[model samples]
Target: MIYDLIVLLRQNPTAEVCHKSIQFLFVMNVIALAAVQAMLILRVWYLFSDQKWIQYSMILCFVACNVLSLYFTIMASQNLKLLNGTIFDLGKHGCRASRPPNFYRMFMPSLGLHTMLYALTAIRALRNRQIFSHAPVLKRLIRDGGLFFFVVFATVTFTAVGSFLTQLPRINITVIYSNYLLSLTSIAMSRIMFSIHSLASNLGSSTEWLLSNVELSRVGWRKGRNENEIIVERRCAGPDDEDYYYDDHSVLDIGGGRDDDIELAHVDGVKVRRSYDTSRSKSPMPRLTESRVGVYDDLTW
Candidate 1:
């Protein structure tokens, strides 16, 4: 921004200066928008359990949006027609870009994805609102996640709106909003990540109780007293659920919880499944002949 101000706002700005400034703005916005989407996608990813369809759909949408954004960015830059504004200058802040073609498509993917992810994140947070205040991890997910979506949504919307405004013959606020677009996206994403990490550091005291006492559908993880076990307690809510205690050593394997491991995802993407060395046990668990608990494959990353 400082570099842009120094270069483009000069009393006698050269053609070379304008060209570089325009290209640089497009490149920076493209990178910033991608960073913003990637981070938002990650946050939403954590809120789902093993719902592969939801996860896969989101991943596909993310890839498609970024690909389109990149393609449109190149197109917009090539099609960009800059007026010298002697050529009726909009002062030193910069002048209107006359779009011969689809220049506004540059930020369209960003605008669409921001709106989509914001809705998804908001819905996920709402689903967990009953435990919102109690679950520290979930609390940060909503608070930090909401703030991130709101800021990015407004920033992209502003840039998108400004691009539309530039299409009109009389409006010339494009440079000002474009400057905000490039700076705000990067700043918002990094600061939110720092806040999430800080929140994670302090959640240790509150997380212990929430882990063990809470049920499977409501709670995310439970830790055991010793390294040898990850005690996942279940207060079965369904009518069909019964007390079925499997004595097989495999049932207690700490690779997360038997076969139906409750995967714990750290806010910043570190996934953990504690390892237990069963061979070291003084009394090896007896194999069970029958059990009512349903066993399934562990949740995929």
Candidate 2:
């Protein structure tokens, strides 16, 4: 579209064409910028999941920034005209927006939004540092989030400076520069999201294993009267005592020891039980109902 606009401008320089081109540029630029903000807001929402107040505040900021951007874009579009008030000689390469009085107002909220998101990400990273210390994927996510924030913030600052420079008589290409910066912002935001998604996919199996280990470590278990049955107990008390213990029908023999039983074994610490001869008429093993006290409870890291 930009190439086509340049070609049209070079072929036929007209006020209507110039106005339409400027309007198109402003609309596209605003849409791209809004997409970038939405992506960042989504990341913040995911990072602070289930926190209603934080989510609401981020959403409110996003909405306010977009509203301000749209308002300023409309104001700029309304004020757009050919340079030097001459339609025929606007520019052979492209058109320029007639600087509006409050052109910078549109982008100020975006800067504020980026700053707020950056702070939120930093806080979240700090708070969860210990919990996710062993998970490199989450660490990379925080790092990438901060890097994207910096990139977008820098672009916004450059846009603001360009907006100011447009006041100078010699600097007439602020619109082009601002559009380019906004496009870059969109690309950077999208790339960040893609990288995070790719990393998550690569780490999905490990994450599942970690979560499973944590869950196993949280639950306590005891041997049932029947040798084949096991009693699983939740470490945390449930609503009622009756709901605390449940019979697990699966057969699990720890170590073939008469009294020894396994609780929550680490991924690499699990010992395989000795296989018995099912063909022989072997007597049933002694029922060991002893509670494995403090065995799995200590498994909680």
lDDT measured at residue 21 in model 1 versus the true structure, 0 to 100: 73
Q: What lDDT score belongs to each candidate, Candidate 1 first?
A: 0.60, 0.61
Note the clash tally of each candidate: 0, 0
TM per model? Answer: 0.60, 0.63
Q: lDDT, candidate 1, residue 251?
A: 23
Candidate 1: tens digits of C-alpha lDDT, residues 69-136: 87877776776667776655666664344553555576677788889888988888877788764455
Off by over 4 Å in 1: 1-6, 9-17, 84-101, 167-172, 175-177, 205-301
- In model 2, residue pairs whose N, Cα or C atoms come closer than 3 Å (at least 3 residues apart or on different chains), thus clashing, are none
What 10-residue stretch in candidate 2 is worst by lDDT? 288-297
| lDDT for position 228 in model 2 | 31
- Candidate 2 residues 26-68, lDDT tens each? 7777787888788788777767765889999999989988888
**On a 0 to 100 scale, what is the lDDT of residue 28 in model 2?**
73
Off-target runs (Cα >4 Å) in candidate 2 are 1-10, 84-97, 134-137, 166-172, 175-178, 204-301
